[model samples]
Target: MRRRIHAFSAVLALLFVAVFWISTVVSELFLSAAAVAQVKLAIAYALLGFVPVMMLTGASGFALGGKGRHPLLLAKRRRMSFIVANGLFVLAPAAVFLSIRAQAGSFDSVFYSVQALELAAGAANLGLIGLNIRDGIRLGRRRI
Candidate 1:
């Protein structure tokens, strides 16, 4: 079961990378409206892809080494880190892209930014779900 989850996580990671790669190429190579829309969709999909991957990782973590630690405390730390990293990575980049796209007077840029925002939001949601899972696991193992 753990191996299956790991394999699923690996595939998800690859898919996420491919989406980003395609988005990058499209954004870098073609500055047209259609290409921008495509990139936006790709970014949105990438964010959606994170949900299952996060679950798999969180499950893998609990299954492997969360045996004796305080689950709430560990989950808190993990969630904080995820939030910080998501802000640094997804939110920051989305803001920059939106600003640039706005300055260029492209309507598609607005949509693109919207999609990036969705990605950031999705990541945050995934983080929270992970926290919930961790808490549930901890509760399940409690003596009380």
Candidate 2:
């Protein structure tokens, strides 16, 4: 049951990040300012769901791994630390900031700059979480 929660939360969090990142990309390329603004607002609000699930992913993952020193577990834990930190420090604030700015139609240099950073950070988290998933699969095969 613990492992199921860990796996489910991890994958759900990954899906959320992927959607956020892709929506940013597609909106910027093709959507009007109003549409982009809506996307920003939506992403910001969406954090209510994303954040808890991500927190659950980290909590359950750590709980299941339980201070193991095995290299695979160590790697997953390391990636998870960065994932949680990046989500809290970088992504969440950026989402809110972008949403407010976009809401006001203030698509200035700062907004775009932050957007770029947010997108990059999102991509990095996506990859790190993906690697965590892969390592998890390997660990499962060993029944550890």
Candidate 3:
């Protein structure tokens, strides 16, 4: 059951990350005001889902770690920590700021810059999480 839950949470995390990345790309590529508004709304709604999914991901990851000293496990934990920190400290705030600017009908250069930074940070998170997932699968296979 725990293994199933862990797998489920990991999948959820990956799904949300992919959605966040694709949405950012779509919003950037097509800069119509209506498109921007719709994308911003989608992103805002995604955040509502992202937060809880990430929480579950973190909780299950820690539970699975189980105080082990395996190198892959340690690496996974470190990567997860970085991803979580990036999301909370950087990505979330940028998204909120962008959403507010969009809501207020402000689409200045600053907004674009923020969006770019958010996308870059998100890409980094995606890569790191992908590595962690690979490490997780290896750990599971080894039963360690």
Candidate 4:
């Protein structure tokens, strides 16, 4: 049952990513510049917000117990993977879009700063999640 739930969650996450990427690509090809820019902004915002939501679901799953390893460990693994994947898959492209959207003008410096911040934030989250994975693996092994 826990595996099923986890699989379901993964499927949903993948679907969301797929839809966002496809929509963005199609919109970029067909939409007006202003519309594309708006879509990019929305995607950036949505990616930022998705991290905490997945974390919550993972934490709740652990608390409720599951069929995987120690529930806590399983949850940690899921959360870490989710964060790392999100940072890589969503945040990177979003940052690139933001930089491109900056228009390479007087505001270019500010745009670069914003893009740097976004990458930094994503990297920080990824780093923390990596640490959690290391610790979780250590603890999980101790139980074995």
Q: Which candidate leads in lDDT?
A: 2
The TM-scores of all predictions, comma-separated, are 0.45, 0.98, 0.94, 0.45
lDDT of 4 at 117: 59
The residue pairs that clash in candidate 3, if any, are none
| Model 2 C-alpha RMSD to native | 0.7
Would you list the C-alpha lDDT of every candidate in the order shown? 0.55, 0.93, 0.85, 0.55
From the highest lDDT down, the ranking of the candidates is 2, 3, 4, 1
RMSD of 1: 8.8
Q: Which runs in model 2 stand beyond 4 Å of their true positions?
A: none
Q: Give the better candidate number (1 or 4) by TM-score.
A: 1
User: What is candidate 4's CA lDDT for residue 82?
Assistant: 60
Query: What clash pairs does model 2 have?
Result: none
Tell me which of candidates 2 and 3 scores higher on lDDT: 2
Candidates 2 and 3: which is better by TM-score?
A: 2
lDDT of 1 by residue, 67-97 (tens): 5466574664466466546644765466446
User: CA shift at 41, candidate 3, in angstroms?
Assistant: 2.0
Model 2 local distance difference test score = 0.93
Q: In candidate 4, what residue range of length 10 has the lowest lDDT sum?
A: 99-108
Question: Sort by TM-score, best first: what order?
Answer: 2, 3, 1, 4
Q: Any residue pairs clashing in model 4, and if so which?
A: none
RMSD of each candidate relative to the true structure: 8.8, 0.7, 1.2, 8.0
